[model samples]
Target: MSTCKNCQNQLTPDSDYCNKCGARVIRNRLTFGNLFTHFSEEFLNYDNKLLQTFIALFAKPEAVIRSYISGTRKKYVNVISYFAIAITIAGIQLFILQRFFPEAMSMDSISTEATKEFNLKILEFIQDYQSIAMMLNVPIYALVSKLVFIGEKKFKYNYTEHLVIYMYLLAQLSAIGTVIIVTAAAFDLSLGTTSLILSPIQFIYIGYALKRIFNLDWTNFIMRTLIFICALIAFTVIASIVTGVLMYFNGDFQKMIEAQKAANEAARTVKDTIN
Candidate 1:
């Protein structure tokens, strides 16, 4: 223990500065070198620990979640941080894939001018409405999951636990979709059809993960899976319809661009005839 010279406040031996008056407290025999050393010792170490924790998290998600809920949270990253990092990585992959993959962006090499216009409009609408769509999806998924899990009290997981599991599944699904989009884009493969097939597979993976994570029986798992799948299909259909309507209205923007292109071509043709 030590005392602050200015305020005469008692301080712990481990404290570098006085809490009461902000006076610098001397460490080990009041030596300046000792103070610096003590301060460094107190605050400057743990890179390896954090790395190890992340490794465990990636390798053993169920164990990590169990540990977290069991009050050993400080040993691993918070769930929100994990989700954020996963989303960021997925987003980057999607962006890169879109930049490099021509086929993923378009269905055919020679899309009709109208179809091209429609696709561009759809892309623009996605950019504008993505956040709203995500927000809406969350509550809808929660409600659907809750309803699906009802009467399955044998699983021993609460509604909130199920919700967290759904969230984890959603994050994983998003990441996988990002990878698929990027890869399809790189190969010039149209993702429209690929997405359709991949959606069900993704749900299957989610169901498997949920079963393992929650120790659910096969019958209950399949029932919950079907319910979730139905919810997903409904959500997708609704979203597609909404986006299609928006794109229909937004088509005029693309038409103006096409018109400008045609006008320029006509002007060039006239200039060439005169020459």
Candidate 2:
């Protein structure tokens, strides 16, 4: 009898695959070439689930989301794993930018010194804890989506389902956004400009995905999309108010004012020298 290395299943000597586990019978020791071949088969093959999932997300999102939600998971990468991959990619992109294109991360050329300081502080926090920030956004997005789609009786997805929905949506966006941001950075684009370019596409793709998932008519889709945008705007306003209050209490506003005065003094000195 031969043994399957993967599952310890008994096998006939002539069998090429394990009957129980379906792993291919490997008769040779592990080597670099074989490892590369295995990786190509798993991730780069034509039938690989990751590639299928990525293409299907844009081609037929409803089928992918519905199948996973209905417990048919083998055909596509699950939400958690896909999201983790996206977050990892995003982290790598941040590292590349900070390492090779540090100036792209700054906003000083486009803003006053005080504004630049505030923006840099925000940027630093985001860069330092981006994964946490992304994880936090998922739940908030799920809540907003659930509230918006509460009236759908036929496809009544619960809060957790909404979480799954946004997880997939955000992961896809992150993947695409990572590529765009990296390419833009290579060409010396500012992070702010790249974000401005991406934000609309992100919103449009989210609306497109939701429309397909719900099979909504154009009118209903537009209405719901606008409502979603308004809800997000309200949330942003509230968060900004709270953040401003916190900044004031922490004396950040005083620092900003001082920075602004120093910047003004420097600008006036330069002007006098020019005169």
Q: What is the C-alpha RMSD of each candidate to the true structure, in Å?
A: 8.7, 2.3
Give the Cα lDDT of each candidate: 0.63, 0.90
Tell me how many residue pairs clash in candidate 2: 0
* lDDT score, candidate 2: 0.90
Q: Which stretches of model 2 miss by more than 4 angstroms?
A: 1-26, 108-114, 272-275
Model 2: which residue pairs collide? none
Give the per-residue lDDT digits (tens) of candidate 2, residues 93-198: 9999999988788665456655787787778889989999889889988888888898987789999999999999999999999999889989999898888889
After best superposition, candidate 1 residue 46: deviation in angstroms?
14
lDDT of 1 by residue, 49-149 (tens): 33444455345556665665566776666666555655676557646655666446553343454465555555555445644544455566766767776
Task: For model 2, state the Cα shift of residue 245 in Å.
Answer: 2.8
